[model samples]
Target: MTNSKNTGLVPPSAFALGGDLNVTRIGYGAMRLADGPERPADPAAAAIWRPPADRAAALDVLRAAVEAGVNLIDTADAYALGANEELVAEALHPYAEGVAVATKIGVLRPAPDEWVPLGHPAYLRQQAELALRRLKVDRLDLLYLHRLDPAYPIAEQVGTLRRLQEEGKVRHIGLSEVTVDQVREARETAPIAAVQNLYNLATRGHEAVVDYAAEHGIAFVPFFPIAMGAHAGPDGPVAEVARQIGATPAQTALAWLLRRSDTIVPIPGTSSAAHLKENLAALELALSDEQFAALSALGQDEAADGVAA
Candidate 1:
């Protein structure tokens, strides 16, 4: 089986976020903006607690991503406790036209490894103001609730963003790691332009949310969009598909996501410019229905394995 339109390696060049703010389909995730152990023995052991080991190189990566045609840059206040936002501002303070800087609030990082949610209206409002200052922008291009605080009503959290949007502090509101029901609840208080969640070719936990966002015209920004895991090893499913597509396993994963939905704007973060380019190149690798189905089945198998474990 083949898709007549996508059979010839054509990816939608851009997606209109919130009926405006058109950004390239392949965006940059700035989480790796700070210096940290690149590949720790345990992936969870790494942390972004301080400025980049080499601030200049980090800045160069940010600038290079934009220069390479990536328009949406994703960051968070929790990163380096606001230092990451500062880095974004430093690299591109007077943002060029069409460059959208998205920052998330409502998460507290007391310790390097600890992430807690604080959704008090006052705290949320203060963070937004601080983000504007840190990002050196009067109005944030996109502001997301980093995580929902179970202690507070969803309405209260989203309502605060609505108030901020009304005040022109936030041009568009978004949510991270939320359920469809939460999205519905959030819409009652305000419009949600995007939903950022942990989604990829290997992880299907948010499969429903991806569909929901697409049906509602909301952008689904998958954070870890290139995680192919062990299945991407040589002789594994991902590698098999990658060989067939004339690309790397990682590129194959990203291409699968790009072909999965036009509403999806994948933010695959990388500290190296070469790897970033490789990720973006996935846009040109179109998958046929057979290849797409093979990867889809692999994803379901991986997801089921995860659930079993």
Candidate 2:
């Protein structure tokens, strides 16, 4: 596998957290692999809500990612329910030694294409077991509580995961879409290896959480590294930087993320190999300090419509 330095692209600074896990700054998300409700033959039709593509080719894209040194793969139990886990298991089942598969449990799918929060302790434990069965793993490397259920005490949810850690069902515990106080509360129960939150150049409400995690040596995985839509508009900063760097606007956005923090792992999802490769290439595209400042200013610009960084 080619490290960032060897590829002649801007190399991501390495981060050491959760013991010996050395992951590339960029990770791949598997949410786009499912064949939707009908499990259609064509991936493009399967992902009608987004771009259309081939499902087999989607799997191939993941395989290529592994070969390209992306050791971390993120997924969730609610993504196509158990199908996404099954696809991940089948694609990387024999298991390359250092690859880390982090999955979440908390969201419940009662019917097709529907997601609901069900973070009750019993439901969480049950889904953890099911995710274990689907992924064909004895101990989940990293398990995240997909969401916090206000109906249940946060301590209760954290305690359930603590018990799982004690029982050897999970190796590391993480939380998603949580506040800084929630993280401190959960940590009192058990050590938190990471925090996955909705953070991007446009949506940075979680900046406090990111700073907190960094200070404490916990990984901060940003879920939508590239915000959806209009990034390449006529006057968009992303477009301006893209033109300067000889890369696409999306690539420039991802490059800014890589430079944001060593602890940040951006898991941008895509079903197309072409887009996947383009996203990875961002790891090598280094922005100058001025360029970083420009992008940062864009996030703060009122005219940019409150895009958070």
Candidate 3:
């Protein structure tokens, strides 16, 4: 597999979000923009809380992604307790044509390193307004419910977002860390254009949701798309695949996701421009049938062996 058509960091293809807004399949996740200097234990935790990122560099990274032809930028108000949104606006507020900026709501950060979900209609509505202000956009390109609130019914959460849409504050709706059933039910309340879930080579708990999004024409945005921890070792399956494909382990993981489904859009976050370029290069990696299958089962072989035993 090879990424020869790398245009900046953007893939050479586009996906029609909700059948309207079009963006590149290889997007940029803005979570790392909120990361200070330390790498968290889990990539997921990196966005929950952190010291403010270096302002100038963060802005440069955002502009560079756009300059590279990457149009889909994912962010959230919960990131850095709202500073991330402000940073994005400061850097790309007068957004370029064909660029789609998406953000999420429903999660609250009370203290450093602590996060809680509040899906009450009032809270969600307030967050939408704040997000709109911070992004400096008339309407969000896509607004995702960051997480399901156990206290509120999924209907209520989606319905609140629907009202925001009706008010012309949101152009589309999305969900994160959701199930296939939840996605189905969410559509009953409002149109869901995308689903952001934790998925990668080793972690694949959202397999059903991933396939559902493909079948339904919903964009499946993979968060933490490069978290191939154990699989990153020199002797690991991912490493062997990378060696064969002539790509880095991270690129191999992302390429597998791209080959896994056309509807899949991987947003691998990074603060450095070099890492961002590497992630976007995965778009050109066209894995052969056999190579794709081998990488697909990289982390599942052990489970299959255990079952056979």
Candidate 4:
């Protein structure tokens, strides 16, 4: 279960987020780049969710992430209600070749603090266009429908995305927070490159979809990769394994995810250069089978809590 091959260097793996694109196993998430009420005005306060050390430092962190070989940058239209995308474009525009910026539509943030689903065909089309304009790209590398709208048929939503693809506005289609059956339904309309769902060591409600994506060559990008907090507390399995390997629990969680599936890409977000560097270093931590099993079991227990709820 141990990896003697570890020269204490991060393992290099490439994941195609859909299309001809390939990027390193660790990706960056820009959800914390916004200057708004949802995020902290001061970067140092934990109560202020998703705060950066400072504006200049936030930009530096992003630049450092890409310089460190993070090629996939995940953001959403609703994140900071479009501010995240703007920051990403500002930070990485004149973007390097092979760098992919994956943005999502379908979720609306009427206020900076509220999220509402607005996946009507017209809304979807409009948001995609807006994202294209904001990112200042002719074609979005990967465009995801942020969530499925129960008010409308899934086909209608997927059909709209397909039309965008046909028009050459979007290079690849993606889905977020979807079930396995929804993925099948979406693929019938257009090729799907990836799925972004809330997944981490403490949350695995979409393991079926993650497994299916791995089996079928679709990328599975996990958001909130380091949100386990107290669940991975001292003396916990994640902590125990982390201690044995000389890695932080957050890094251990990310390493376990990388070892879980080749298609799995963890986009851990941060607005600090130090934390961003630490998160990306997870690529270097090669987890053992024992560690993976223990973390997997912890996720299962957390899933049971959700089901019991």
Candidate 5:
């Protein structure tokens, strides 16, 4: 791979999260660290199930990402039954200066594929303490409610995090897979530092959430941020644009997200160290106004087709 650093490529930009923590614009997501030796026979049951096939290599990837200037590392308590957090701590505990390891709570994995939202206030508190233990940190840098349990009141769910913050166990609170209305409502209970949602070039379901976060000075962290739809085919708009920019389709998709909003941060996950560097290198990609508009329209088209991913 060509070394973008030696080619005078600019590093990823930085954002001041919650007016205190500063993180690189392009962060690393740790869910993929759960990739392992076992795969369930049922495709629907194939989720982040067991420990990685190579524990040592997973640890290496985490450390290498930090060494490459990634300050924000995203993971969750549900991933591999919270083993993902332990792996992160095993790799980079006593973390480097300014590094923030963000994790999520409120979701439970009954089986390999079943993800149930359990936002009971007591349960949330219990999970936070467990996360603190597994991550080996006195205070979690950033903690997110993985999903809002529909049966519970939004205030109580977010309020639990507020209580944790008051106790100094969590520095910041975030929400995932929420609507714009949910964000406004949650803010009534606590100060939300970030919003993690499923967003990408082909999936524009949360477009309004992106705009709302930008307007409110909240970070919009897009998970599964590298996916592209049918339009990314060889003769499609994505391919045409990738060829023009001399970047891979993934890089082009990331560049579009970076240009989407100032408050936007894309945490694309990868188990491969080489793929990690390639994703980070996307920070150097600069899209022209025309190119940006073209790629931006791709999402609009996908949304029109009722793409739900």
Candidate 6:
């Protein structure tokens, strides 16, 4: 928690995802381990010819994360057309107790760079089955509908996950990239346990969503959670603060998010084991009230000057 390096670190405190799945507040995102684009310009070709990520390396990262006390690992089927999930299985099929693996469905890759929503009850059910097989699990620790299907009713989409929970395929259901209203609506249809959204120091438009998740005891997971813009400048507040505390700007950003709300779980992803350790070490960087407030107020000056936040 200081400028001096500390070895054999203990990870950040744990959070109860869905009020039951105990996981470290600082978790790892599996997307980077996939070694492929989120949406390929040629998904069909990539699927047919794409090579797997370094198997030994990916396994090392997974084992390292677990050893670091990262109990929660986030991923989706759309990532690498299922290779990521398979790799997770290959790396940690006989998952240790207390390790929670979360995955998503409802988005499909149909053509080159094309994403299709398949929220039909049958499609959702089938994907759950397939994901279970890929992750090599009897039941999923957590399942998220990657995104809302514009063509389908939100209730139906959430309701499908409820059915899966009833069938014991998934223990909990969540929504991703949704607004506050959508979270409320989805909750009425089924117990919404978590909300994943794009939130970072550079973007704060989803502030209301974060607040709602906190007030409702729903975990708010921010993907692509990192420092950027003025906050990441070499001479800016973030860098200065990080330097003063002997941490990286990226780690400063993660620490800020940790102080944002107890419900916030920032799953920062990285392909390098070194980077993953660096990101996790941010947990030790506790910010004073002034530091946290400064980060929370980031981009306000730009907005006051008519600059985009």
Best candidate according to lDDT: 5
Candidate 3 CA-lDDT value: 0.84
Q: What would the per-residue lDDT of candidate 4 be over residues 205-299, giving only the tens digit for each residue?
A: 88888889998899999898888866688978888888778888888888888888889998998777788888877877876666667778877
So what's the TM-score on candidate 2? 0.86
Task: Tell how far residue 284 is off in model 1, in angstroms.
Answer: 1.2
Better of 1 and 5 by lDDT: 5
- lDDT of all predictions: 0.88, 0.79, 0.84, 0.81, 0.89, 0.81
* Residue range with the least summed lDDT across 10 consecutive positions in model 6: 3-12
Instruction: Report the poorest 10 consecutive residues by lDDT, candidate 1.
Output: 1-10
In angstroms, the error of model 6 at 199 is 0.7
Looking at model 1, residue 273 earns an lDDT score of: 94
Cα deviation of 176, candidate 5, in Å: 0.3
Could you give candidate 6's per-residue lDDT for residues 79-187 as a string of tens digits? 7778788878888879999998999999887653666777888888888899999999989999999989988999999999998899888998999989888898999
> What are the per-residue Cα lDDT tens digits for candidate 1 across 181-242?
89999999999999999988878878878889989999999998988778788999888877
Of the two candidates 3 and 6, the one with more favorable lDDT, higher being better, is 3
Flag the better candidate by lDDT, 2 or 3: 3
- How many steric overlaps are in each model, in order? 1, 5, 2, 1, 0, 0
lDDT score for residue 103 of model 6: 95
Question: What lDDT, from 0 to 1, does candidate 5 have?
Answer: 0.89
Q: What is the Å distance of residue 230 in model 5 from its true position?
A: 1.8
lDDT of 2 by residue, 235-277 (tens): 7878887777788888888888777776888899887777888
Off by over 4 Å in 3: 1-12, 35-53, 301-309
TM-score of each: 0.93, 0.86, 0.90, 0.89, 0.93, 0.89
Where does model 5 exceed 4 Å of error? 1-12, 36-41, 304-309
Each prediction's RMSD over C-alphas, in Å, is: 3.2, 4.8, 4.3, 3.7, 3.3, 4.2
State how far residue 203 of model 3 sits from its true place (Å).
0.2
lDDT of 5 by residue, 146-198 (tens): 99999899999999999999999999999999988999999999999999999
Tens-place lDDT digits, model 3, residues 14-117? 78889998888889988778763266555556654653447789899999999887999999988888888888889897999998899999988765556789
